[model samples]
Target: MYVLDTNIISELIRPRPNGGVVQWVDTQPLSSLYTTAVTKAEIYYGLHILPMGKQRGDLEQALHQFFSAGLQNRILEFNSTSAMEFAMIASYRRKAGIPISNADAQIAAICSQHGFQLVTRNVSDFAECGIEVMNPFTE
Candidate 1:
């Protein structure tokens, strides 16, 4: 299984004219698509920057589409298991002297804990976390 990063989801949610790569990626089998609860938060927070009009409605509609898609998508909820995983990830980061956003760190930890490959546009940002990374853009 693979977890889709927020930026990739955003692109898929509202494909750009030049987003041929995103469009192509979206056509792939849904069996491989997944996203974390953090990604859900990212998408929701992103919508706040837009006007409270059609754009907000559009974003909500996109979210509905994601929920209806035939993927076994699950929110990577935080629990004792995830907390342990997060602590371990943070320890590693601390030892390595790496700085990462809390949300990014949580995403990396979830992927690592669940043995899921991370599909993202920002490979370099996650490289230090040592999780498997797939850039659909290059595929």
Candidate 2:
């Protein structure tokens, strides 16, 4: 299984998404693809911060449709198990003097809890999290 990071998800909504990412996604089975609630929130927050206009409206519509149609029940939630995993990951990173954002930690927790590899453009951000990561933009 694979959990799509926010950047991977965001690329899909781009006017001209990266060809490498698109091709990589296309080669995977839809059943193997998953996303976290954190990713959903990130996408929504991004759209929310944009000024209201035709561009925003169009992007919103696209995003809504993408979530409603493509993702459906594949969105993972960060529950108790994930929370515990988050605590461990955060503590370890902190002690080692490696900084990770809360959002990235949460996503890493979900991936760790579920034994899923992460698909992201920012592979290095997740390197120390001890979860498998694949950079679709590169491979």
Candidate 3:
């Protein structure tokens, strides 16, 4: 299984997303992709900050569809296993002088706990966290 990061979902909802990512996603079986609840909240958080307008309305609808697709497939939730992974990853980053936000840590934790490869554009950010990451936006 694969974990769809927040940036990946954001790219998909944008007016013009990375063609490589779009193509890569299209070629993959929908069942192979998954997103954490954190990603969904991130999308909604972005939409919430947008000024009221047609653009926001459109984005809201797009987010609804994006979430619906994942819901049908699976939306991984944070659990005990996730916490164990998070503690290890967060502590390691701290000891290594690497700074990662709580949200990013949560995403990484879920991926580690489930052994899901994370698909994202920010490849370097998730590196060294003991989670597999893929950047489909690359050539």
Best by TM-score: 2
Ranking of models by lDDT: 2, 3, 1
Best by lDDT: 2
Clashes in each model (backbone N, CA, C under 3 Å)?
A: 0, 0, 0
Task: Give the Cα error of residue 105 in candidate 1, in Å.
Answer: 1.0
Off by over 4 Å in 3: 70-73
- TM-score of candidate 2 to 2 decimals: 0.98
For candidate 3, lDDT tens digit of each residue in 2-74?
A: 8999999898888989899999999988899999988888889989999999999998888888788645658
Estimate the TM-score for candidate 3: 0.95
Question: Among all windows of ten consecutive residues in candidate 3, which has the lowest summed lDDT?
Answer: 64-73
Tens digits of per-residue lDDT, candidate 1, 1-139, equal 7888887777676646236556656676677677888888888888777788986887788777775563344666656786777787777887888767888888988898898899888997787786899877776
| lDDT for each residue of candidate 2 in 1-139, tens digit (9 for 90 to 100) | 9999999989998999999999999999998999999999999999999999999999999999888888889999999999999999999999999988999999999999999999999998997898999998877
Quality of model 3 by C-alpha lDDT: 0.88
TM per prediction: 0.84, 0.98, 0.95
lDDT of 1 at 67: 55
* lDDT of model 3 at position 80: 89
